[model samples]
Target: MTIDRCHQVLTAIDKINQQDPNKININGEMIAKELIYGHQMTACLNKYWPTANEYLQIAVRAQHVKRWHIARSTYPEGKQGYLTWRKDLGKMHAELAKDVMLDCQYNNEEAEKTASIIRKEKLKRNQDSQILEDVACLVFLQHYFEPFAVKHNDEKVISILQKTWKKMSAQGHEIALSLQLPEHLAALVSKALS
Candidate 1:
């Protein structure tokens, strides 16, 4: 029954994400960006923390739920804008996930826990939250880092990588080190750490 509820919620989230007009080409197929992002989060969670509970799984899967609805350009063009956009997105994702959980028959307690995880409450002070953060960082490093690196100057790219690295757990760092990033990006990541 619980598993069925989980699947229903996941399906609903995917459907909402499928409405996204923005798309990315993944392995020759055009797919909704957030849909692929959610799949990547799920995959990273499973790979890095196989025993993750359903709450953590749900939170991770909905990490970027309906992200396209909020465009960064809607805010002012600066660090404050980026931060505000990210903060708003986190709250929006949590609220959306909670609504789905409630519709799926999850009790308020369970739904609230999921929302808190999605909001990243407690972060480094909470194990589950930290795990989610780790998965997010791993996903960025594996999939987005190269493109992000290309768009920014080396100093800015390295600074962002440093921030990403600080958010990750030691295990996440291990997984990141094993990833085969392109030569230039890998060098920047290495330089960031040094």
Candidate 2:
């Protein structure tokens, strides 16, 4: 029963993400960006923490649930705007995941627990929340860093990398170091660390 409910919630989250209008090219195929991102998050979580509890698994999958609904352009252009947008997105994702969990017949307590993980409540203090942060950072480094590094200047990329590094745990740093990034991208990461 527990496993069934967890699978139901995960499937529902995937269904919602599949509606993403934005597409990303993956190997010669265009795929829904958020859907692939959810999968990537799940893969990272399973790879690094296969024994993760169901709430953590669900939270990871729902981290960016329907993210494209909130356009970054809707917020102002400064750092404050970016931070606000991120905070809003975290709230939205938490609420959406909570709703999905309830719909899947999870108790309110269970739903709220998963939502808190999605909101990253007590990030450094909460083990599940910290694991979620680690998985997100790992996924970003493995899949998104190259494209992001290509677009931004070295200084900006390094700054962003530094911020990302700060959010990750030591275990996450180890996993990130194990990734086989392209040579140029590896150099950029080295520069960022240095």
Candidate 3:
């Protein structure tokens, strides 16, 4: 019964993400990026932490639920604006996940757990939150980093990679090392690490 309820909640979260108007081209198919991103989060969690509990699983899946609704443009420009946007997004994601959990009949404790994970509370000190951060960083490295690198100067890209590396655990670093990044990108990552 608990497992069934969790599935229902995940389905509901996925359904909400499916309604996103913004789309990305994947494999010659136009699909909602957030929806695919949710799936990616789940996959990464399973790969990194196969024994993850239902709360962690659900938290990973809803990390970016309806993220596009809050446009980056709504915030000011520059580094401060970027930081502010990220902070607000974390809070918003937590609130949205809480509502979904409550709607799914999850108790307060369970809902709060999910919210904390979404908000990345106690990231380094909290094991579960750190796991989530690892998965998020891995996802960013695998899918978004290349495009992000193209837009930024090499120095900036290296700085971002170094920051991402710091967020991940040793296990995440091992997994990241195993990924087959493009030659140039791999060199940049190596440079950043060195």
Candidate 4:
């Protein structure tokens, strides 16, 4: 949001102009902040209970990190490795969620229960839409900024994707509704009182 951060993010991105750079480190924090502040995540996430912003913050940060790892990671592409990574992602996210909930003063039992649901939802995403999410992310990136077209030699493609994501949209959320996200994503669109 800050102009300095905006430039820092772009410059970080500029470095990996060659291929897929590990963008998570550079963009994850900012994107996490954007999602929080832009979505009014404080309001949306707080519906479940008081002091819920912390929960959303941790999950958002964790999700951004997980995606960064998946996209930029160099592990041999295989069914088992991908599945393991997916499970690990879910576990880490849930743990982060639990930490936030407990910090917000929720009892350990309640926090654990909430984190369990989060974990389940996270895994369900791997099952129902991970591929869709991946494709959608790539397509959106290509369409708006064409970062991959930078001709990465694989080493820098991750960087390209990361930088492109930050540079393409800060508060300009219109593309997300119509981009690669499922039809459900569009439901977030506002229908003013008529």
Candidate 5:
């Protein structure tokens, strides 16, 4: 069944992500960072776009599948390096997700469809890809923004926020504005927007 295959693929992705050596503290408990990220992506998708198709759901959940495997330090320094690293990571995630889908018995077309979503092909032009991008932005705002802000100066943080904002949709902007961020972080977001 389609539902069963979807579950199988998701479970397989989770299994690989669980091997992440990095840990993050959530509510006083340490958890695998990427593993929690996958869950957060799913939570955001379910909350904002409950009727999302299985391919979108799988793409969102596998957005950062086994992300820690590629260390940012492995790439050259500066913006070009960062961009290259991100592009490579996207390809890696897509391939890994497609492999999982195929292993779960998904047809080649179905597997490629999900993989393309993971790669965020066509971004603004692809509805599913845009939704995945929105979910990722929302998750960053809700769970990761504050901590990230703390480590960077306001100017840098604002610049990063601006870049993140540019990648999101109007719907994503609305949801991001509705998040209950810490007061300082909220001020930074307002500053970034203004």
Candidate 6:
């Protein structure tokens, strides 16, 4: 079974509160600003918590999962293989967070807050992936393709990366609009392939 992040967050918060009275001092808007744990743990909590606060009874669940068994993907860590493995990490966290919320009855606001956190984290991770590729691509070009593109002082490789970025940025935006998870490139697989 998938672990729920909401429940875990609530548990962590409660545990912290029990340990120290001063930590839970802030309520309302300051509640979100409160820090509960270390880096990876915080990333986990934020990604799974939901946002609906008015009624406060939020339950976020991971109903389904889409996977990329193929092993190669666009970020060119060779396209499908490692890329899928990398995103699976986010899916695991998301599942954990959803379970946590279900146990706590944390309302829509809390659930949404968690979702927002995850989305933000996913974005950062995606950017990091691209940066890794961009750097490698740059070096590769410099050593090999640079001579061809640079003759007449042209930046063919650089321009290609820029254009590729334009497409990626647009794709990211579209997915955001549809509320698709950042790790959800699989949702666009057919289109991407075609």
TM-scores of the candidates in the order shown: 0.96, 0.97, 0.96, 0.36, 0.97, 0.27
What is the lDDT of every predicted structure here?
0.91, 0.94, 0.91, 0.39, 0.94, 0.36
Measured with C-alpha atoms, the lDDT of residue 80 in candidate 2 is: 100
Report RMSD for candidate 5: 1.0
Tens digits of per-residue lDDT, candidate 1, 22-92, equal: 89987999999888899999998988799999899999999999998899989999999999999999999
Please state every model's RMSD to the true fold in angstroms.
Answer: 1.1, 1.0, 1.0, 13.2, 1.0, 15.9
lDDT of candidate 6 vs native?
A: 0.36
List clash counts for every candidate, in order: 0, 0, 0, 8, 0, 40
Model 6 ranges with Cα > 4 A deviation: 1-79, 121-194
lDDT of 6 at 53: 28
Give candidate 1's error at residue 182 in angstroms. 1.9
Summarize candidate 5's per-residue lDDT along 79-133 as a digit string, tens digits: 9999999999999999999999999999899989998998999999999999999
Off by over 4 Å in 2: none
Per-residue C-alpha lDDT of model 6 across residues 1-194, encoded as one tens digit per residue: 12354345545444432432223234433222123222223232234323332111111112111112223354456447565655664455344455456466656555555544433344335543232223223323323243444453324444543443443344333432343222323233223333
lDDT of 4 by residue, 1-194 (tens): 23343333223322222232332233444233223222232232333223433333333323322234344265557777776777776676566556655544566775565455445454323321222233234344423234333444533444544543443332223344344533322222221101
What does candidate 1 score in Cα RMSD to the true structure? 1.1
- Model 6 poorest 10 in a row by lDDT: 55-64
Residue by residue across 55-108, what tens digits does model 2's lDDT show? 999999999999999999999999999999999999999999999999999999
Worst 10 residues of 4 by lDDT: 185-194
Q: State the lDDT at 145 in candidate 1.
A: 88
Cα deviation in Å at residue 101, candidate 4? 2.6
